[model samples]
Target: MKVYKGIGVSPGIAIGKVYVYSHKYVNARPEKISSVKAELKKFEAALKTSKRQIKKLSAKISRHLKKEDSKIIAIQMHFLEDEVFVEKVTRAINGGKSAVESVREVLQEYEEMLLKSEDEYFKDRSLDIKDVGYRIISNILGIKNELEFIDKDVILVANDLTPSDTALLDKSKVLGIVTDSGGLTSHTAILARALGIPAIIGLKDFSLNVREGDEVIIDSENATVILNPDDTTKAYYLGKKQEYEDRKKEILALKDIKAITRDGVSVTIDANIGAPEEVTKAIEYGAEGIGLFRTEFLYINRFELPSEEEQFEAYSYVVKAMKGKPVVIRTFDIGGDKDFPYLGLKKESNPYLGMRGLRFSLANIPMFITQLKAILRASAYGPVSILFPMVSDVKEVIKSKDILQQVKDELIQERRDFDKDVKIGIMIEVPSTALTVENFIGIADFFSIGTNDLTQYTLAVDRSNENVADYYIPLHPSVIKLIGMVQEVAKKNGKKLSLCGELAAFKEGIPVLLKQGIRVYSMSPASIPEVKKYIREITLEGKNIPDGFHQGEVDGGL
Candidate 1:
């Protein structure tokens, strides 16, 4: 009769027996020594085998679920092949430990760090390493570790589920998901949404408290999980479940409807995506175009920069799929918070302000132009435009366009077909850049206000620093004034302005933003329907915006 409240990352309901899944402690530090080369070879073979298995699982899951939910397997496979991880395992083996013993030792270091990390995102990442470690060690020992579904429907309770674990799960038998740790951006939440299952995350200790086969009701809509509920509560949830299903049907009906405001103002809503596969999900959710195709994923999950042809294939896939629905692709916004160790990027004391985004690209011009060439080549296929991130001045914009033009000249000599009219744009993220938007607006064809970084830099608060998290307010008066200024100038100069940050998804500040004349909104796929519906119901009605918008409580979206 106990009720536990958690963050509802996915919406729906499921009634099932509890199936608690946990990994057994592996203390297999062998007392005797084994041949280093033989053991190393054995570990290598197992690692190779695990890579194949993960690839197969990814392929199978992509066929059933949306491709975005299944892309994590590729990331794990990258870890399996990472030179650092490989060298560490080799070093451990050379230090006179058996294959299983050495592998466990090296992975345990990472597992412990993640479990001990103060940052919530880093702490949740332990689940991924542990899941992969289990696979590799089990492969070496010839052991099989997987979720065993009981004879009836069940809800999975775990500290957290990795993309590998969640991807291979028996979707038909497992009715819902409950996890001890994760956030809205976690893969567990994204996978659950893509799978259309009810899920609750950041449950704290329900995995430890809940028992096997105990009847439970997972109410994701209300973010509640009830254990051994009384008859009355069980009946109430069952009726509530029916109502949710009915509402889902109604929401789906509005998918093809236009996302126009109540005053008959037509607004364009697009989806921010990671991989090209996610473009399908965006279009399926009624995204008119790809607003922000983040190119960091191409660099993150690989050993080296993707070649021009490889990058071209990926970009062309989305460009063609949208069927002339203008795709705005942002170049590799890596380095700052998004680390690519294989690239040999120097360690910085203050990475957020150091080498990152457009700054990183400027330093590595050869690699930068390679990616630009690919995007330009893909532009020939369909509607495509390039957007730059972390831009601080008009000079960087001119320099980047100069390099792009240089590449275009080279492509012309080689007789390559590309859109000579590909548009160039910059993200207004830095406080200085936002304050002086008029200086850069003339050269840029369009602008997207990256509210995430704008809020961080404007308030001089590190969003990742938990101690100062309260100061990172998106609705602060200065932040609003900056955005208002950008909106006013972009309008007066006849330049198109859009909000592509996480703030675009939430409706809490919709009234304030609409009055600012932000007609273009881009967000995640799951947000499209809700945002579209909210936009249609509300109109500015010439409401006056408060001067000090930061007076009340504000929860930042992105």
Candidate 2:
């Protein structure tokens, strides 16, 4: 057995064959061509060949993978047919460049354009285009470019992997992944995490330094990888692997079990989903409902905002897929850090405090109402709830509610069936909402604490800003005190309070939150089993009364 070490990103163990991705480009010099027309003819042929190859790959992807897995390939198919890209290559070839030279020149130009972009999403998207281009060129040259599987237990390494590459990976055979580039929020890292594969990224020069088929051991929890391990290290990893497998089996057994405490206190374990296909995964992971269905994805990677019919189709699918499960759809919270190219939102000087959340919704009332109407219509098919983001005060909540009422009234006047009684709630993130909790208690149906933003706002530190990220602690005394206060207010008014934040998913934070009288903990579906396990382990000895607050009157239920 040979091992090669690289970064370990996500935490999970797998044993799969090594499938290395390599691309081969054709080298053809047009300098020997007697006429520019000949060079142009060659370029046209290359373009045709590239298009055919992309179509073939796309067909293969659709045939072999799930519908969700083939989405990225479908997007790439559009790029392959882009007129500008084709025109650029043709122009370069007309200039008497070789086929390889023309393709490379056009790709370089596009890459440079994308590299100059200020938006990270667009910059990353450019990388996808480059990868597609390289793959097309490689296919044109008749290169047998595919991942190589040499071992039963293999660790896949790459300089950087695209979403398509990650999707194409044979998860059944691939054990772990290590890459030289990508951040925690990068698509490659997110995909690896979703697939439950141990992954490590952002290691400098890993591809250049690591050799193929070298023996490796990956410690995913700590993001460590050991190359060509010694006997002692090998033995240590074997023990660790056994522990992991045992724990995994234990978790798997609890998959169908309800998330009820030992004392019979039932907590709703809902999943936070982004895409329609994720609804199935949520159900498979034993999620009782969809707590937070982000709608921003509909606006991303597109040329315009999704039409009402389009939005209805997507929302309807998710609601129908959930069967009878409650699906809480959050209104579009775009602007600030999240931009829509079609919306023409300029870069903000201070995005976190700029036009975002409720502010953006209020400013674009028509857009907000359109989504509200669609969501309400979908609610008729299943249990659906509307969640508004960034509610700092009761006035904003009132305004949003007023708009929702208007949409419902209009729908009723038109004799359209709509869920007029759909539950309306606010995301209690800003400190103002926590400070003046009573004003919002009766007005809103429930409160979903977005701790990621609450902590950032309370600490006056940007969570995305690494410089002061340490100060943005969800468990800080101030933050804990505020959460305690909010929970107390919710209890006093007989309202439901749940947390749909990163903090709720943390093992340490869950115990503390539960002790503070938090009943519902919403998190990523993948985290359901572990959170449920922790809840089951809570004994009387482990329970502690929260400081600086009383439980007040417990009333109302989800």
lDDT of candidate 2 over 1-558, digit per residue (tens): 344443344775443333344343324332455676766666666667766765766675555434544555655667668898778877776777765676777777877876665555566667667766666555444444455333355778777786656766666667888777775545576667666678877675666666767666677655676666778878878887887778767775676677666667777788887767778767877888888888876776576677887788788899999998888999988865566666877677787788888889899988898888888888888988889888877788888888888998988988887677899888998998889988886688988988888888898987656567567777898888899999999998888888887787765576678768888877776677766766666643466422311111110000
Instruction: Please report, in order, the local distance difference test score of every candidate based on alpha carbons.
Output: 0.79, 0.71
Candidate 2 backbone clash number: 19
Q: TM-scores of the models, in the given order?
A: 0.84, 0.87
Model 2 — which ten-residue stretch has the worst lDDT? Answer: 549-558
Model 1: lDDT equals 0.79
Q: How many steric clashes between backbone atoms does each model show?
A: 0, 19
- Please provide, for model 1 over 1-558, each residue's C-alpha lDDT reduced to its tens digit, 9 standing for 90 to 100: 999988777778899889897765455444355588888888899999999888887887677555444656766776798898889999988988888787777888878965664334445566668777888987887766557444557898988887766776777888999999887657788678777778998889999998888988998756899999999999998898887677566666676678777778787888888788878778877888888899877664355778988889989999999999999999998766566656777867778898888988999999899899999999999989899999997888899989998999999998999999998888999989998999986799999988888888999998766569689887788888888999999999998888877577654566678877888977877667666766777657844322211111012233
Q: What is the Å distance of residue 221 in model 2 from its true position? A: 3.1
Best by TM-score: 2
Weakest 10 consecutive residues of candidate 1 by summed lDDT: 547-556
